[model samples]
Target: MDTDLTPLRDRIDAIDRQLLELLNQRARHAQDIGQHKHRAGQPVFRPEREREVIAKVLQANAGPLLSDGVTAIWREIMSACRALEARQQVAFLGPEGTYSEQAARQFFGSSCSFAACTDLDEVFRSQLSGSSAFAVVAIENSTEGAVARTLDLLLAHPVQICGEISLAIHHNLLRRHDGLDGVAAVLAHPQALAQCRQWLDKHLPGVERRAVSSNAEGARLAAHDASLAAIAGEQAASQYALQVAAPRIQDEAQNRTRFIVLGGQPTQPSGHDRTSLILAVPNRAGAVFGMLKPLAAHGVSMSRFESRPARSGAWEYFFYVDIEGHQDDARVARALDALRQSCAFFKNLGSYPIGRE
Candidate 1:
């Protein structure tokens, strides 16, 4: 026989009612703040402020709930309150169920609107054209070093990095049918195909692999054709009404993707921040070292350094660097000034809060 849970259920119900009352109270306070902001001509959403709020809430968290759960709860609460002021419109590459879409939701929460674009170019265009407030685009992955198209777009577009999201990736084999039997062609993005290469080689040796624009697109195709299967996340499976043939089939167990939030305005320093920049140093023998000397002198820490071909028919390259502090910081500003003097081409890609994994 099971012990009675009526009293426990009643207690939880009462607590939930209290939570509802408190949330509404918070929302009303947010609306009052929004009124003041409107009078001051200030923007409704502030990324730096949101970061501080999350950090403070996490610091005060007492236990019971896991850190992730607490973060999610506070994020939703803030999101709801923010919606009372203004709901953000975010853009991402997808029909639906793409990792980029998930990353956008992770950053902005479900209270915001989403504009799904066919390609990365469209994703960037949506925000640049004022159709969306921000664009969440994949920058790099653990298995795949960088998304080359996104990096190139970053160089091409007049956009600024406002925030970031680091999402754990788990690829599942999705199909209309339950088993892998009769699955003719496997569909997925090229990177997803590469990440699960070893698994595919062992499980479905002779199956044809077809590359698509995104995993969600592959999932959409797999939904209609029982002969085709998709390598994507569980979200794709649910979105397309497909069954999971195999779950977490990626070669690496700890695969993750880093997505950057692109916006028109630069973000204010959030104390804990990361500044990104694109540079092309003069083609002198010690030019690269000369450019880096200021960062060392100013005591600025560099987290990432990546080089991409400049495509000018010459052998020149563009270097992308991520530093520890915001560009507004005194040390970082000084380093950036010296860097500008040392480079042939320099582009400050805006500073934003460091994404938590």
Candidate 2:
């Protein structure tokens, strides 16, 4: 004899219907808020506000669902609501299927519009030209370190960081044919090629490595050329209709890349935030040490510090620093004030809510 399960199924269906009704109510309220924002000339998409919402929900959560799952569900709901007000136009490096694209979708959600650019420079240009409201570009990689072009563009462009994403990258060797036979060369972005250097050397010895604008672009090229195998992500393999000759070809198993979300205005203080800056100290003895003393004195914590060449004839370096607090915080403000006196050049790259791993 079999036990009857119709009652449980009926209960689940009733709960699902209730959930749908509640969701619709939330969406209606969101639409009403959007109308008010439009009348007040306020931005529809506010990262800080979204962060606060997520925090509140997480604080109230006591369930079998994990924090990540809850955050993702709420984000999609918020994204859809914001789109009803005004769909955000976002830019990223691509022809589509790049990790940069993935980061953009992750941050903005799939409700926003995407403008794919051929290069990082174009990604900035699209936003500056008003073609896109936001731009996402990879700034650093765990294995390969900083992306120099993105760093340079950040300095040159008027855009600032409003948010960030940390994406775990998994590279795959994709080709048109079934197997890796007749594969003459490996194509991918320079960073991708470097990330998978050990794997390529051991497997496809003596294959010429060609760097392209992006891993997706390499995959696109490989789709048409049987002699070339591209190193890209699973998304590229699916997008280009290529077969994954070999998966997870990167040297490191847990390779990750950090991408920054760029926008025109500075984000409001989110209690938990990170402030990025670019500084050049006076060319003198103890100048660098003096520049850092304020943080120690004020009891502010620093998360990252890197030096990029100033590219001037004289040897000067620009120090990029990421500190733990918003610029408005008393301690951070005091430290920045004292820090400014020792610098020849200083640029605050905006404070944003720190991205979760």
Candidate 3:
């Protein structure tokens, strides 16, 4: 006999039975917790708690399965348990197969409901209108840079950033045809098209590139037209039943996008956390330097700093900054107070756990 997989599979089946029993037990306990939370008027979805559980599961994974594979299995199990508690409806910038929808599903899971929004404004509006409890939208992408519309929406909306998620982007060129002989135009969001600019230039130099509202929308359009190809994530390719003409087409191999979860309430400190702020510096000399000195002196490490034109007047601008400590931390509190006195203005964007891998 070459080998006997029967005995190994039987043992695995026994272990899987035990796991199923434990998972059901966990679900019951989760439902009980949900009941208590509802009675106490607390939010059912706790991102920090979920992060802790994911970290624990990923650490305990030993062999055979990769970290991401294990995480996906655990996420689905957790998603089922959460569904027992209650269904949560989330909205994202979408036309069904967009990256924002993928990010939302990655953060929330398959069991939860999702609503598609045409734009970032619609994402916020859906939540405001009581149509969605939470919203997910991209903040920045490593290859193409910050999404200006998302930044502008954050300024206009009063929502707080409750959680953050980073998604690795692998753009695929999808089409329904057997070959690219007759393909005339490549359609995708401007960002997606730009991310794969080199690849498109090399392969389809003379083909016209058209911008669409979203990559998913492009995929949808491509579904009906044989002459078009969509550059979108794998999920879109699979969802639309399109053949992948090309995959991993982004110019940057390490392409990733940082997305944020927006909700009405702020989050409590989760120990390992980050805080975001939007402030304005005076026009005088060393304005930016003076405004950030307090954070440096207080030992609060800055993670991100960006600027956007302010609505007040010409040449007026606001600075967006992310620092390493929760707002309630003593040093962080002191830094915020000191900055208020030195800066022209400041808006606290809320503190949240630095979302884990």
> Residue by residue across 17-75, what tens digits does model 3's lDDT show?
99999999999999999999889988878877777888888888886999888888888
Index of the highest-TM-score prediction: 1
Q: Write the per-residue lDDT of candidate 2 for residues 1-357, one digit (tens) a residue.
A: 124787888888999999999988999999999999889988888898899999999999998899989988898888988898888899999999999999999888889999999999999999899999999999999999999999898888777889998999999999997777788999999999999999988889998999999999999999999999999999999999999999999999989999999984677899999999998986788988889999999999999998889999688899989999999999999999987876888888999999978
TM-score of 2: 0.95
Ranking of candidates on TM-score, top first: 1, 2, 3
Residue 246, candidate 1: C-alpha displacement in angstroms:
1.1
Every model's TM-score: 0.97, 0.95, 0.93
- Clash totals, every prediction: 0, 0, 0
Query: Can you tell me which runs of candidate 1 are displaced by over 4 Å?
Result: 1-3
* TM-score winner between candidates 1 and 2: 1
Cα lDDT of model 1 by residue, 1-357, tens digit: 124887888899999999999989989999999999889988777888998998888899899888899888888888888888888799999989999999988888889999999999999899999899889999998997889999899899789999998999999999998998998999999999999999999999999999999999999999999999999998888999999999999999999999999984677889999999999986779988988899999999999999999998888899999999999999999999999988999999899999888
lDDT of each: 0.92, 0.91, 0.87
